[model samples]
Target: MESRRRTFLRIATLELCERFGFYGLQSVSVLYFVRTMGLSEQGAIMLWGAFSALMFGVPVLGGWLGDRMLGARRTVAVALALLATGYTGLASGMGGAAGVSLVLAVLVCGGGIFKPNITSLLRHAFSDGDDRLDIVFTIYYMSINVGATIAALAIPFLAVHIGWQASFGVSAAVLWIGFAVSLTLPATAPPPAGGGDRRLWLLLGAGIGVAFTLLHYPALAKICIWIAAAAIVLIWIVLYRRAAPIWRAGLKLSFALQAEAILFFLFNQQIATSLTGFARDHLAGTIRLAGVDWAVQPGQFQSLNNLWIVIFAPCLAALYYHAERKGRPISVPIRFLFGFVLLTASFVLWRAAALAGAAGPISPWWMVAGYALFSLGELLIAALGLAVIARYAPPDGVGRLMGCFSVFGGLASYLGSLVATYGMAGSGTASTAGYTHLFGNLAALSAIVALASALFIPFARKMDAHWRHAIPRPSSTDKTPTEILP
Candidate 1:
């Protein structure tokens, strides 16, 4: 148990460094596209959306590589190298627009390979049905936010004071540092039984082909994303059919929860696009705290999401831990409903702020308050998303299912970006009305999701019971399963 705990910590450290680089780049990416790349605001938003979509969308292939060809550790090592290379390319600024696009292509490929496998590697340290999985994953989630919060605060500052290229260079440096740290960690999973080298070469070839396609064919890339999404669905159907009868209920529930998670990601996308735009166009640059006014960069507002997550994640994790100790732990489905409720309130709060500040800039406090709710909702839904897969997904194919989760999220992210684009007012136009309408629409959607979650509770509980009974207890010493509500 102590060794497993140590393994989790080391893996979490790797996650922290990876997120530091990833979110650092994301913090300044849109503005970099607008200010440095000479793209229009809308174009920048769409480009960011596309980049996000691909970052998530490619994980299906990555998960397959980890599950079937390369082991989790090897896959992650390769991904870290690719990510560092991509960030270095961005820092170099070699080819202008084309150069940046090519670098983005590298990032998408690297990110796709990195995201799912790392999480799978972390989960590999624990046995199936370990009661501590929820708390462990929640803490793991917080590690990600910890990295994001620091990067969010620091990278934007660097972008503003130094140069954009310099900020990206920092991201590259962080990843290389992570790669160095990774060497000391023991392998948590073994390589495949055979053909690992042959398959590694094949995946490398395929990755290069993918990068070339993304660099040269923008429209084709979009089409490929949709095609990949369709393939993911088809694969899910196949997996469901092939799963043992006892495992089918859990897999179905996992799929349902992941689908619902898509809505949360839609709202999540606003932090990068519309919300950042709002901060730049409407809010004051400096926020007043206790006694002093502190200046803030618009990009730094993105940090609020991570900051709030860092503040609240441990609290929620403790609550879950205590509840489980009493054998009345809060279920993931109930948490999902609560998440949507908070998300609804967040959008409503933002809408009220937009309306109240009709005459002039609003208080940055409003952004702070809105993000508090938004981040809590994120903790409930997004943070526990992997927990859902971990608890319910078949042990044999959990890695692939994790990738499917990313695919659903990527699709939602792209759709959310489209939604944000509609709320974007033209360069010289008043944005208040548009933002108000957008927030109002989001609030309504969130309410509808909340209601659906409530309706689905009974079904989810039934599925939970089915899964609990179907799987044998791992050992005599394993803790009893928490009681599910009738």
Candidate 2:
């Protein structure tokens, strides 16, 4: 038990450090681009969407490389080095749109590699059927929130007080520290996918460049994302056709759910994009709490999701614990269904806030309420999604499937960018009616997604049953197996 706990701590610490550095740059990115690079609101959002797409999208290849080639530890070290270099480069003021885009490409590529590999490593660290998995993940989730909360609070303030470059430099230094710490940890037993060659490396290089180029042009990026999503569906279809009869249903259902997962992220991303702009443009400068005035900055509102997560995660864990003890624990699909419901409620709350703002700048509490609801949904869906994928994915290709799952996040960013751009169309100049239209549309979209997810729950439950009984469990003593792959 002590050994397992130590392993968990090591993995959790690595995750925390990575998120801290990543969010430090991301928390203030919109403002930095707008103020320093002279980007329009829409332009900035689109760029962010592109950056997000790569961060999630590239994981597909990264997972392949990690699981099949270099092992997770080596992959992590290489990724962190790339991340630190990108941060340092940007701190030196990568000039203009093209230059900055290039630097971000490198940064996001590192994240793509780091994200899925670490997750795969963590999943592999435990024996199958370990009841402690959820609790461990809950703590892991909290670690992420801890890092994100600190970055959200500190980076924005630092950017304002000192300089934007200094904030990036700080992020770079922190990433280097994470890299150093990672080396001291116990090594993971590598999985059996290892087959990368020179050609694969060259193709990966090309893919990164293409991703950067597309992101540099938002219109092109949007079009390309749709194309990529379609291509992914086509690939899944081909795989399903060739798959063993027993595995087809699971594949079909998993793919459908992953595709639908995009909708959740579509709504989720407004926190960073549209919500930031909304807080900056519409909220009162100061909020009054208990007869004391508090200054509020729009960037600070970005931290609210993390803040809510820290507060709500333990409550969620307790709920799950009690439920599991009673033999009525929540299933993955049920969790997703509940998540969609909460997402709809969150948007409705935001719409109400937008309506209240028509008279004048509204209180920050409105946003607080909305984010709290959304954060609950995040805990239900996003935090649990990784575990779900790990559970359902074929034992031989867990990392690859997880990578594919991350693609939905990319698609969501693309779609969410469109929504955010529409939401902030007129920004400082839009009339009350314009804001009303924006929030109403978002609310309607959220409701539709929730309804759709509800309809799929029955099917998901059935698929869940089929998968659990079908996949062969590894022997208790066999911690790693190569035969599962080929």
Candidate 3:
């Protein structure tokens, strides 16, 4: 138990630093494109969508490399190095818009490589049946938010005061710090078992080439995304058909949960795009809290999402742990249903605020309130997403499945960006009415998803039961697996 705890902390710390750098970049990315690069709001959003899609879409390859080639630890090391390099390039402001886009491609490649493998390593550190997995992942989720919250708050402030270059440089420095921390990971953590240095070099070269090509030809993003989406579906079908009968139920459950996750991410993507824009244009810049009026930048408002997560993650973790200890743990399906409901309420709240502020800027408090609910919803869904794969995916294929999960999320992100484009103000000045319409449509969509989730509860419960029953249990006399390393 002590060893597992240590492993968890090390991995979580690494993730925290990576997230700090990544979210810092995200906090200012769209704004940089619009303000620094002189792109229109719509163009910035579209480019962001393309970047996000590729960022997540590449994880499928990363997962394969981690699982079948370079190993998770080595892949992560390479990814961190790539990320640092890309951020440094951005900080230098070398080639203008084209240069930034090229560096973004590098960042996308780095993110794709890092995202899946680190979580897979954590999942491998524990026994599959351990009830603590949910609690562990929930805390892991909080670690990510901790980094994100700080970056979201600080990076944008730096961008406003110092310069965009300085803020990006900070991100580069943070990633280098993460790389240093990665070296301290315990030897017990998974090590490279397959593929040689040759394979690693080849993959790195191929990834960069593909990322650069996709970025240069933005139109290819939509086509590639659709093709990737179809490919994932086909792969899932093949996996389902080939899986053992006992594994089929779990796969079905995983597929359903993953589909739900895709929908949730569509809403999640708005945080750095539409929500940030809304905050910048129509929302009050100052928020009152406990008799203090605090000024916040539009980008800084993105921190509210992570801030709420930091405050509530521990509470949710405790609730989950206690419930499991009491042998009355909340079911995933129920959690997902509640998540969608909260998401619906969040959009509704935002919609109301947009309408109320049609004449002028609304109180930032509306954002705070909406983000609280939205963050909780994210905790229940996005945070647990990996837990679902860990709990339900076939052990041998968890890495690949994790990658597939990210692919779904990437597709959803692109779709969400498209959705946000509709809300973009055609002129220089953004109107509250555009946001009002967007939020209203989002509210309707979330409500429909919530209803669908509620309706699927019974079926999902049956799937859960079959999966639990199908799992093999060790006898009381048998020792726990030592693969996790003590």
Candidate 4:
């Protein structure tokens, strides 16, 4: 157990570094689009959304490669290297909009590959149905927030003081360090004993080729996303059909939770895109603390959610631990409902801030409060989301299912981006009325979902109880399963 903990720490540390690099670039990316590239608020938000979609969308392919060909550790290492290269290009600043787009596209692919495989590796390191997984993932997510907070605080300051290019350069350097660390980590999962068939390789190659081509054409890319998404749903349906009766109920619940997750991210994703626009247009230029004037940029405020996470994660984890020890543990559906309620509150707070700003540029404190709710929601939902995936996925399909889990984020990003684009369409600037209406609508949607999830909690609990009874518990001496991906 000590050895496992140490190995997990090593993997989590590397993940922290990778996230530092990823968020460093992401924190300031929308600002780059708006200020450096001279794009409209709508254009920047849409582009950010598209970039986010690709980041989440490519994971299924990455998971397939990791499980079938490269192995998890190998896949992660390759992705880190690619991310380094992409950040380096962004830092060089030689690229116009087109060049930046191409660089970001490469990053999207690398990020997609990196994200799921890391989660898969962590799951692989532990035994199936391990009780410690929840704590492990919570700690893991805390590391992510730690890295993200630092990036969010630093990148915007660097971009504003030095330049956007310099900020990106810092990210590139961090990613390279993570890549170096990755090279030394022990392999968690081995590839199949025999090499996969030639046809599988051909299919992967063809898929990559298609993705590359469509990236240049946004319309085609969106179409491809829908088509691929449909295919994924079909695959899920087939899996459900093939599952035995006991497994079928579990699978159904998994799909239900996943569908709910999409809704969660739909509202949660605004922090990267529309939220930035709101902060930029509405918040005061500076925050006065202890009679000291600190200028606040929209990019810098992106850290608020991470900051909140860092502050609250340990507390929340301890709360969960205490609850379970008391024999009154919180169930998944209850947690899901908590997350939705907090998320809904976040939008409501934002709506109130927008209304308040009609009189003057609102205080950044409003955004801070909103992000506090958002952060808690993220902890309840996204962190637990990983455990849910590991719990429900077949040992053989962990990587693939984790990849599919990322699809929820991808779909949310695409929908959020489209909504942000159309919602603020023809509104040249971020007007008070526009923000009020936007946030009002979002709040209402979140409220609806929260109530629905609450209503379904009883059903979910019943399903989960049956599912738990159906699975065989592992003994200490049992060998952990090695998934062989076809």
Candidates' TM-scores? 0.87, 0.86, 0.88, 0.86
lDDT of 1 by residue, 159-178 (tens): 88988889888999988887
Q: List, residue by residue over 70-108, the lDDT tens digit for candidate 2.
A: 778878877888788888887887778877888888887
Candidate ranking under lDDT, highest first, comes to: 3, 1, 4, 2
- Residue-level lDDT tens digits of model 4 in 186-297: 7776677665546545654564455455554567767867886887788787777776666766777777777777777777667777788788888998998899988988
Q: Indicate whether candidate 1 or candidate 3 has the larger TM-score.
A: 3
> Distance from true position, residue 57, model 3, in Å?
2.5
Residue pairs whose backbone atoms clash in candidate 4 = none
Regions more than 4 Å wrong, model 3: 1-10, 67-71, 120-140, 184-195, 392-397, 428-430, 463-486
What is candidate 3's TM-score against the reference?
0.88
State the displacement of the C-alpha of residue 394, model 4, in Å, after optimal TM-score superposition: 5.6
Candidate 3 local lDDT, 1-486, one digit each (tens): 897898889889889888988889778878788776677877778778888988887887887778777677777888889899998997887555677777988898888889878977787787567789877987887788889989999999998899988988998898888888777765434545555687778878888887777766678877888998999899889888888888989899888877887788899889988888888888887888899998899988889998898888778879977877776777777888899899999999999988888778889989999999999998888746777778777877786777777888888998898888785656633578888899999989998888988998888887877777797866889974311000
How many angstroms is residue 251 displaced in model 2 relative to the true structure, after the best TM-score fit? 3.7
> Model 2: clashing residue pairs?
68-193, 68-194
The pairs that clash in candidate 3 are: none
